[model samples]
Target chain A: MSTTKYFAPSVEYAAKILIYLSRYKSKQSTLTEISKNLDINKSACLRVLKTLEANNFVYYNSETKKYSLGTYISVLGKRVGENLDYLRIINQFLEEVCELTGLTAALVQRVSFDRVMFISQYQTQIQPRLSISVGNRFPLTEVSYGKWILANVSEEERNYHLREGLKKVTSYTRTNLQKYIDELSEIKRSNILVSRQEYTNNVTAISSALYDWKGQILGMIALVGVSSLIDEAEEQRLCTVLKEVTNRCNEHLIQLKIEAYEFPYESKITQ
Target chain B: MSTTKYFAPSVEYAAKILIYLSRYKSKQSTLTEISKNLDINKSACLRVLKTLEANNFVYYNSETKKYSLGTYISVLGKRVGENLDYLRIINQFLEEVCELTGLTAALVQRVSFDRVMFISQYQTQIQPRLSISVGNRFPLTEVSYGKWILANVSEEERNYHLREGLKKVTSYTRTNLQKYIDELSEIKRSNILVSRQEYTNNVTAISSALYDWKGQILGMIALVGVSSLIDEAEEQRLCTVLKEVTNRCNEHLIQLKIEAYEFPYESKITQ
Candidate 1:
């Protein structure tokens, strides 16, 4: 909450270790393996892990002589996931979108500046539905969801990722940095972004940003399917429905803002 | 993990603040209120909260000048929620229980020394089912889920909470420590626990522990509904289905152990 950043080394290291555990692996790891892989000294790692364990941030198994994150971490994560008013709003709206359009409808959240987390998703009744589990995190710059978020962040932050150079995932990947920036600006201006075979060979995605009552970008709500499902006529329909989803979310969020006094931690997705 | 406990005061205090926030209030609290209420020094509270905020463990709303837990907490909670293999295994098994008995089914985990957490739940197709959400936490000495976990923990740890004296929530609430201890022992020896309106009126719960391959109690799976639904005739059917559910989870956990070699973290629930 401080205007000036206050750094705490032990706290920072503990967080880094948790992020590493969450990102790199889900199973138990030995002190040796964690210390070596994360490059923290064994003794200090022992202290922090001990602290984390005592606080229910990590769990230690004596028989296996290894460590894994504790269940309390999910208690925290549930709080985070619960704070997204859009998730509540998207429930009926996403289902309706899927019902009307016969495609997958999803809500993604920007976890890190350059990574988006799939928080909620629904699949249509069509055969051979595209399925991805909730809580899946991916690089924002590599997928259509990435462009949807990249379009909202500050131009400097977007340029930082641009300067890192977008990798060619498919032949259609945009390699021109300037053109990519231009494309992002246009997406931002238009409030929609489209991708065809940018991450995988056959999948195509169309995404539009979901906004809170104050107009801050929360993330993207999108409808996706195979490339064949996204033909010229379908794209227009998809855009219209996707736009409707966002508008509905915004409306629900405004209602939630009115309902804010009834609870704490409401409408926290303004950013 | 070391056998001897090494106390970290700072870490301990930080956890206490978080717990207080979770238990006492879900809304934003100020430094003065938290400091005076928790009896922590304002300066020290500021430092710890700032550290927590830095790690995305807490969020500060500059507009209202208040603090609530950050979204990252739920991100961690989701990870922990994802780790509960029984939740994954009990999906089909729970539906079977609900289908056979027309009652709600659920899974609960031991979250703290004196508390149990509801991690997964399923509703029956029948109208007016008893509903308790996932992530709901209650005192370990009061609920059927508590007795299931109390039956497993060390005698000393169990006695500490027992000494706290269970409050009378309903007419069936067990307030006598001796009776509570006897109840827990019977449940532990029998490997199951049942509650008839011990916590809430007109509700009944029957629970049995789910163990990993190592025979450690990972959590509990049960069917619960209106007290009338838990009639003796129905109790037998509930036990049969619940046991099947536990067996299915154990089999899945063993399969996971075999698959552990393919990933870095595995068989973590043994802790």
Candidate 2:
């Protein structure tokens, strides 16, 4: 929690290795493959992998002479999932949105200044539904949630994020700086974003920002589906619902305030 | 992973810190508190924490000057949950057990030689259900699953586990090694474990080992409830059902074999 950033190289390598394993979890990798692919020194990566294996962060398959993510990652994940109240609350709200709209609902968390990742998602029991999974990361300048994020940050920060040229993700992607800025201003006013195949083809997304007590954007809740499935009337209804759900979520979070910071790790038995 | 254990101290400290954060997730701990409690050197801990923060493994509260497990932990956790096929299959089977038996059903994973943790659980809607949560660890020599684990291991390995000797949990606890070995033999024949208030008072548990294609005991599936609620007839019925469910699970797992090693990380849409 230091103000000045100081990274431990070994720690960074370990995190990278764990993430690499998670990314290609279906493939168990040898020490040589992992060390080479991640560009870490062979002996150093081996030491970290060995340490991870001992801690159960990565599982070692002795017979195959390879490694995969171990039990501890899931253990830590379950603990975190149970502990975070805001996450739980947002998830409940997202479920409601998913059920009502019969679309895919996802809770995305801003991981860094320019990056956000889907932490949890609820998909409809409908054929040809969106196949987005948790852990998928997107840039702050792309996607509906990204606009909500850009709409809330300070002007300087916003410009810095956009300093990188806009990506034309699809034919429908908005690349004009002025129009994008205007939309962000609109998002700031209405607290909702509506994108018609802006990031991905045939996908329409509506998103609303979740705010802490200080009005800082924590993250965003989004509803995504194929654009063809969402008519003009449907998009309006979706936007309205997202705004209300996010508003209620933000209000509840504000009232919970700092106490919400204390995430209870226990899963209560529901009678 | 190497044959000779060469732990990267910094990596070890990072894992320990993250686990500690998960253990006391409800509390945001200052650097001094974390460093002192985990016995990690202050500067070394700070560097690791900073690195973790950069990777979103730990969240740093600038205002409070404290730390908590960050967004990336949940991201990794979700990916692991999705990627592990055995976990998904077992969870599905546990859900069936909970519904059919109206008891708390849990999928326990062997984390180490002498330790196992509840990776997932399904509880019935009935009142007074067992309140065990995921991430709760138990010694491999305790609980119904522990008994199953003991029964599956080699006699020498089992003896080593019991070397510390069993602490009599209750009057019902079987402290006699002779009787315990006889029961383990019975378990080997039956492939089912029935413990009546042995580990915790007034708790009855039925467990069956899950096996890999190699026929090694991977972990266990356990049904738990209050002793009084499980009448004689109910216990017999429960035992029969658990045996059937676990048998099907084991058969399916054996068929899965090495391909099961590759966990699909995608959340497929259920139509």
Candidate 3:
């Protein structure tokens, strides 16, 4: 009896092709193009593409003879959200925040220095909700999430990150070595970061850092809306709610045995 | 002149790793496991994972010596939602349907028999709101989307499909040779299919097919909610709304030069 391990090998190849397709989602590619890009043989690429097409992971445009992500790729994303428990944990709180503040609630995690990835959002039930998307990236220094992350960074690490991270994002982006050091100190004192239309005109965001059980800064959850919707009073009210939610989430994390990070600058006066 | 395409290729590889990690998100996998799963060389997989770790697409657990998807992945998904224009188009109408009918509204594209990916959803406000995830799959014959899709097959093709597709899902699944022929005929006559507690007890769904500008069935959009919420009068109202919204969506498709399939079924006089 001869036993062949064919499924694993083919599944592996299929996985690679899927990875490649995800990178070139906006730009369609042909078999030859994929072959050349991945440096794999043409036949192997063709085989992988065929399998993906069958599974609805990739689609071939018969007219152009090019390939793009199939509609099913979005389905894969939906599975990711479900498996990660994001929908269960965050949905209601996000809706409440959006309802109370009339601002979009965005959850962002740091991906790279100038890029933070958006995970989920609850949009305000009004015209011109802050437009953003899942799997999109934003500069860490140009948005509330970026500032919130920076506020949690150590003093020594702040300068290095600012120089390397904020270089490409904004012309008005702060680059002064000493200024960043001082700003981090101030943020540490405040335990909150406010960006007044930093990312876009008339869009303001207030963000606080979220922690895992191990005390690592996991990400930032921000409440963003038009500046007109968030005056000083409204901002303060949002801050209170945001703080409470963060605290509750922290407790949830602890219950799950994830470590929680403490705010560096804790002040009873602000509360 | 030595031009380094280092960043582009690495970025591409890194993106692939991100997508790969997306599949095995909750369970940490070692470098060897990932290489074997992706069918890349062990050394190459390590390099890709390193770059992903550096970019925060993955996090390495030192103690376990395995890697899990970092918080950054969720962040990226959120950003993708914010930036994707097509989602916004569907979301506007999805919200209205949810509000009018007080049921969960879903925009889904068929992935496979095992999966139907959710793009966007307006979940019911009630506790224990139908637990549907963005990316999940169900047997085609047991769900609203499946019935609607099944109704789209041509006469001869429909028979072949039932023989192959219907036998696998459920024992109570409509695999009766004559009954299936008649069911498809009825669906063709009515243009809408209803699954009354077929997938889950006390849950009902009514779905209509959607087409692209090219007249291909893109997928089906279904209104799903508890059976109690969709009484006969409410069901009629919700179906009217679904028809209107689907028509509006079809108009958008036509503007893009897409043609919709004409429904063969006429309104029944009994109702």
Candidates ranked, most accurate by lDDT first: 2, 1, 3
Q: Candidates ranked by TM-score, best first?
A: 2, 1, 3
Candidate 2 chain B least-lDDT 10 residues? B262-271
Predicted candidate 1 versus true structure: per-residue lDDT over B69-107, tens digit per residue? 654565556555455343445556667667877788877
- For TM-score, candidate 1 versus 3, the one ahead is 1
For each candidate, report its DockQ versus the true two-chain complex: 0.28, 0.36, 0.14
Q: How well is each residue in A67-153 modelled by candidate 1, as lDDT tens digits?
A: 776666655555544543334456678788888888888777676545677766789769767876565778867776887666666
The DockQ-based CAPRI class assigned to model 2 is: acceptable
- Model 3 chain B lDDT-worst window of ten: B262-271
In angstroms and one decimal each, the interface RMSD of every candidate reads 6.2, 4.6, 9.6
- Candidate 3, A1-271: lDDT as tens digits: 0022111333334444544555525446778888887777776567667545544456666555776655445544544454444333555666776787777887777654445667678887588788666556666565547665666656544544466554423444455556655666676565566776655667777777677657677676778778877789988888888877766766665565443222222221132
Candidate 1: docking tier: acceptable
Per-residue lDDT tens digits for candidate 2, residues A78-195, read 7666565566778899899898888899888776556678888898898668967788777878766788777776676678778886889899987998789899999889888888
Tens digits of per-residue lDDT, candidate 2, B164-194, equal 7777888898888878878988998888888
Best by DockQ: 2
